[model samples]
Target: MRYHINFGQNSSSFKLAVIRALTGILLMTALASCASQGAQEAELAAQEAARVAIEQEAASLAQEQERLRAAEISRQQQEQAAEQARLQAQRDRQAAEIQARADAERRQQEELQRQVRAREAAIAAVEAERQQKLDRITALEQQITSISASVGDSENNTEFLQQAISVAEELLDVLASEQEKYEDTDSQGNTLRPLAKDLIAELEARKDELIRRAGTQ
Candidate 1:
């Protein structure tokens, strides 16, 4: 009876040990499953953060590219404007040079015309002086011819003297008529006085000689 009692007590202790071990194993399994579920949630959060960062980087890159394009377009417009201004300045300078050359040519033509007028004026003055000299020479020649005719009549024979007397009388009558035309004017006509007096003296001498010869006959 003592031995059986001791065996029974030992069996009860063993069964209690087994029950405690089973309960400890079940608690360990539940704790492991909760840890695994927490690990999966942490991994999903990290992936979502990485995706958001990538989207932000892409947006920034697109904006930078748009800014570069706008800056290039503005630079091209400035270069074209500068080229157009340079061309306009060159054309204006060329037009100014042409105008200056035309003005110089006009002045040269006016100077040439002035020189031609001066030359013509000089020639006209010379022609007028020459005409005046010709008129003075013609008057002197007529006076000399009349003086020669009067001197020749004074040296003649009796028959020639009678014929000379008649001729002298006719010439005296014509001279008296011409003298009456100048009677109202002064001796400022000094050239006509000497010629008229010489003709009158010749006619008087011829008439006296003719009367003397006729009385002797």
Candidate 2:
């Protein structure tokens, strides 16, 4: 009876031990499955973070490219503007030079016209004076002829002396016209003097002779 009771107790303890071992195996399997699921979730989260970082990096690169392109375009535009300004300035300078040259030419033409008018006036004056001299010479010649024809008469001699003094004064007036020929170049037309030097000397001699005769009379 003692043996049988002992066997029964042993059988009961054996069954309890088998049940405890099965329960421990089931708990270990469940813990392993939970660990595996956590590991998978952590892996997915890492993948998602990597994708987000890559997208951000790509966006940053695209924005940098856009900024660089904008900067380059702006620089090109500035250069074009500068080139346009330079060309405009060059055109303005050319126009100004042309205008200045035209103005100078106009002034020169005006000055040349003034000189021409002045020359014409001087020539006219000289010609008029010469005509007056010729008329005076003709009158003097007629008077001289009459005086010589009546030379023996006493009244005629006195009249001849007075006529000679008048002729001398007329010749003195002509001397000033001849002097002006040298002073005013426009009057000197390729000759040293309008009248010959010998003719002037003869006239001077005639004047002195006439003056002496007038004083004696």
Candidate 3:
């Protein structure tokens, strides 16, 4: 009976040791599964952070390119405006030069017309003066012829003879005065001075003859 009881106690102790070993193995497997899951989550977080950084860098580069394009457009607009202003100034100067030339030509034409009119007026005046001088000379010659005829008809009457001598003396004085006025030669290289001198001498001789005839009558 003592040997059978000792074998029963040894069987119970061996069962307890088997239960302890199984519990320890289960705890180790749970710890290893948790470690592997944590490593996978960390790798996924690192990939997400890299993608966000790349997107932000690309957006910044696009903004820089837009700014450069705006500045170039503004510079081109300023250059076009300057070139238009320069062309406008050149056109204004050319217009002013054309107007000045036209004005000078108009003034020159007016001056030439005035000179032509003045020359025509001067020629007409000279012709009128020459006609008046010719008329006066013709009248003087007719008066001298009439005086000589009257003197020959009245020689026998003493009172008429004396009057004829007085008239002839007045005529001789007029002819001498006319001769003095013709000091310069005419355009034809002749003068009325010699004819006036002959008339004066003839009248003086006739006046002397009339005085002697009147004293005898």
| Top-lDDT structure, candidate number | 2
Q: Is candidate 2 or candidate 3 better by TM-score?
A: 2
Q: Rate the local accuracy (lDDT) of all candidates.
A: 0.61, 0.73, 0.63
Window of ten residues with lowest summed lDDT in model 2: 184-193
Off by over 4 Å in 1: 1-37, 114-217
lDDT of 2 by residue, 150-214 (tens): 45556735765666756655665665566566554534332354555566677767866874675
Best-performing candidate as measured by TM-score: 2
Which ten-residue region of model 3 has the weakest summed lDDT? Answer: 185-194
Candidate 2 global TM-score: 0.64
Q: How big is the positional error of residue 68 in model 2, measured in Å on the Cα after superposition? A: 1.2
Model 3 misplaced regions, further than 4 Å: 1-57, 123-217
Which is better, 1 or 3, measured by TM-score?
Answer: 1
Q: Put down candidate 1 lDDT per residue, 108-177, tens digits, no spaces.
A: 8998887677656654554443344344334323433443454455544445445545655555564545
Native-referenced Cα lDDT, model 2: 0.73
